[model samples]
Target: MKKSMANGIENDWPPIAASRSARNTINPIRRIVDRMKISPNPAKEMISLSIGDPTHYGNMLPPVEALEAILQAVQLPTSHGYPPSFGTLDARKAVAQFWSRSNYQVKPENVILTSGCSHALELCFDCMADPGDNILLPRPGFSLYVTLCQSLGIETRFYDLIPDENWQVNIDHLESLIDDRTRAVLINNPSNPCGAVYTAAHLRKILLVCERNHLPIIADEIYADMVFPNNEFHFLGILSENVPIVSCGGIAKRFICPGWRLGWIVVHDRHNLFKDTIQPGLIDLSSRILGPSSVTQAALSHILSETPESYFDDILHQIQSNADYFYHSLLNTPGLQPIMPQGAMYMLIRINTKDFKDIENDKDFFTKLICEESISCLPASVFGIDNFFRIVLTTPMDKTEEACQRILEFCQRHIKSVT
Candidate 1:
């Protein structure tokens, strides 16, 4: 061994490699997005409709109540200290009260706070299934679920969501994927890529499958209560009677504050199925990160309680208005089919590649759009779907109109000639 006199170490040291967890942890969005090496048109200003962050545009912002609460919290002596690993009692209680419905009451003990909804999901996935176990996720779903499951050494099985059916989960397909090693089902309502909201009836159908298979549910309700008029958002936990539910949520979307880094898991096990096992496991896992910021937890109560209903109404109005415009405007764009989102701040448009002259797939459409029109939207391949792209509806009306017009022109330019 060639050793140095000072360190007595081998000159040819073995190569260090990343752990299996780190190596397997791939974000499909980042991976697919990074492959687009082309630049946007310099002549036309770039309008990004890809990012999920509601705060990307200045038109939407957190309410004064939340800001005031945070201001008050930072000044308090108690807010400076570390809270319990899961969360402070007051913070947990506030979450419980906020989520509690007239028929379905949530308890503080069943709540486990984390750094953010992502952290809450990580804890839920970690606690529910061991390595080699499988979890069923939605196809065309938020890619993070696959990233987390892969990183944790858990196998991911996907169920289909029919785009024509307002992006409703194909119930038969969901149940068909379940097998002996399947541990849980992850359902994201007002889903990210699809922007589809599940009705109570539809949610009950999913719960029935879980109940039959004795599988627990990990409800990704981060966009809870964020539905447009004529549509109702149902919590799987509230609708579930027999199936135990671990619901992950936060104020990230509704409050329009993604950077707050505060979220929680609400355990809903009416029959105490998770009381001794999953509940304690989640709490134990939360200890590793020590939960969210102390000041944020301290401010949560005031933020939850004092924020007016009109604030949410205004936000919803803005999102819905954008949705309406995108749906109607893109309808005229040849080779593009825009699915009007029932809820959430996204609109998923299908690219009819066969109807286009040169557009091959979603990635091709995405590349050409940015290079030509300076409009950036996420290709749905990142979300495990093809020939579709997703756009954010949180942009101001003016920007939304501009994006629609640009997209229309781009589609028309590439669309196959009728003659």
Candidate 2:
């Protein structure tokens, strides 16, 4: 110990360290990707398929209506003030109406605006369980779930998703993980790493499990309604008969505006299960951060109502086109199998490690691809999977084609010979 005397007082100081929450909050993607010190090939320009942000390539962007709304909002004298902690009444009403259906009506009173989908999830997790309580998450799921749980001192129990079956949750495995301390089950439809959309029947099966177990659901529907041509997106909140649902969604993915940092939690409590407890807790917790930007909240109503369906149609077409190309192109590649994405903006490719001479795993493939071919993709290990990597489908067609060609060549060069 070191002490210093000043003004007739002795002071002792020790090295400062991060809190347990801060130290345990590890983002696997950043930790893994940043550790790879290999530089991209000098001869070739880098094509990054790693990032989840759609705005990275500039080919996709927020619709004209959204932009105009923001422009109109910024000029307003009333837009500069702080909104209610949960959200402005108008903004919350907009969210409710946007998600409302002919069969089910969403109430504005149940909505809680958040900074982003991530924050929405954080609130859901925080409100549902305390430290040492467990939440059942999907295996090969979004890494943020694990990070947030760990940071909050909540236990994470993973249930497997069947990749061959379009990454559907193993319902049996999911049900088996439930115990006395299990607080909630997190479901990500139109999943990120897998891009698998659940059917109505599949969603019903999951709902049955939760209903039987009396467990509430935390639905990650950030990619809601972003399915491909043949597939349909189903909201778990809509499907659940009795199980209460807290759906976390935002305009980030659907509107291509990640930087906007606006999201909301829609509480679907048909039986009033959450009306007395979790709902109020979420609203109370939101008071700490005071919600998102007032300007953005002012724009949210127009952003939700004025954006044409054709805008979303065009976005889905582009993503499906990219998914089609990657699925077909990589099928011919020697040691990789691309899982056809049903929806969302990513495709997971399984690296047949045994077929490659030098590649050991997904991380090896990821490192070598960037170093030799100047192509970057995320190793699925960060998403709690192995021998697979995920790539974004938001790149321009030209870049997608170039990336496919490079990946083909990279795999061809590394594939083992049968002799």
Candidate 3:
């Protein structure tokens, strides 16, 4: 072995050393957040649109009932104990009841409580695919999906999500990528980064392709019910019964309580496919982890049962307003092309590199913009794309406006001379 000396949060002075695992564990989102923290902005305060948590905004708070439930749960003596590996019966039952619809009902047994949607993903990959197996994922999507799969020795192959078609999966591309070693297909609806919600018809086609390939569907619906105007959020469960679907979601986004760290994985095995294999394996995997907070799980029943539809409606409305304003403004700017988001709290704005006489690429463009405008957005290359960056629409209206205005100024400054 060579030498390891004070790299990141890993090995420090005089320590035995950091493992190779610690050296390679990188989360792109956190990387941007850390840079934003360390980078000296001449401006008073830097505005960041880099993080995905909805609760970061002061204006958006979790439901009053959910908050009260947490308070009550924290007081209960039983809340201090460890949560069961699968989850509390009440929490699992609430999940089943909340997600269950007429003719598409799921029993409490189907829900496996997890620390968060990310942990839910870890468990799904743990059960569905072994080392050396591969899974198909959406390009320009959540980097966590790729990180989680790769960390466990499970490989990932990305398929393009058609930008012009509202970020729907290119079924042809998807079908072509499948082979004997392929194990599962993962999708995020009301997609993160792209903000494109898949239509029911399109979802069916994707599911059909997976079914033909005999692979399981790992649907990351963590943005569940955050759908904005003109688009309906389709639950993957309702679309297919023949194929096995692992729907991952939590109180993080919907309830605006990401810190609560309460999430669940509901196995929709209509045909009893994963009942014996993956289902049991998920329990074993979850067992190895301490699992979600007992205090959070204790309150999950009340939170899921009582949160009003009006609460979700208001949250969606705010996301819609911010996204629309940013999209239109960026579109009108000289050196920018923004893809209007149909849902979620993100939109990818393409940097018109040809319009910039001085800037080199997306990285150079964003670095300059960050230092000059006191604003931070994630470069698209982190999510497996380039010439684009993502903006979160969860900021308050006034700040959202200010950030967009700053972005326009940056774009206008770099306008190349037209012959």
Name the TM-score of candidate 3: 0.93
Model 3 — which ten-residue stretch has the worst lDDT?
4-13
Off by over 4 Å in 2: 1-12
Model 1 TM-score on a 0 to 1 scale: 0.97
RMSD of each: 2.1, 2.1, 3.9
- For candidate 2, what is the TM-score? 0.97
Which candidate's lDDT is highest? 2
Instruction: Rate residue 386 of model 1 by lDDT.
Output: 96
Clashing pairs in 2: none
For each candidate, the alpha-carbon lDDT, in order, equals: 0.93, 0.95, 0.86
Question: Residue-wise lDDT of candidate 3 within 180-288, one digit each (tens)?
Answer: 9999999899799899988888999988898888988999999987787768899997788689999998889889988888888999988999999988899999998
Query: What tens digits encode model 1's per-residue C-alpha lDDT throughout 86-140?
Result: 9999999999999999998999999999998999999999999999899999989
Residue by residue across 1-419, what tens digits does model 2's lDDT show? Answer: 56766776677778888899999999998999888898999999999999999999899999999999999999999999889999999999999999999999999998999999999999999999999999999999999999999999999999999999999999999999999999999999989999999999999999999999999999999999999987889988888889999999999999999999999999999999998899999999999999999999999999999999999999999999999999999999999999998999999999999999999999999999999999999999999999999999999999999999999899889999879
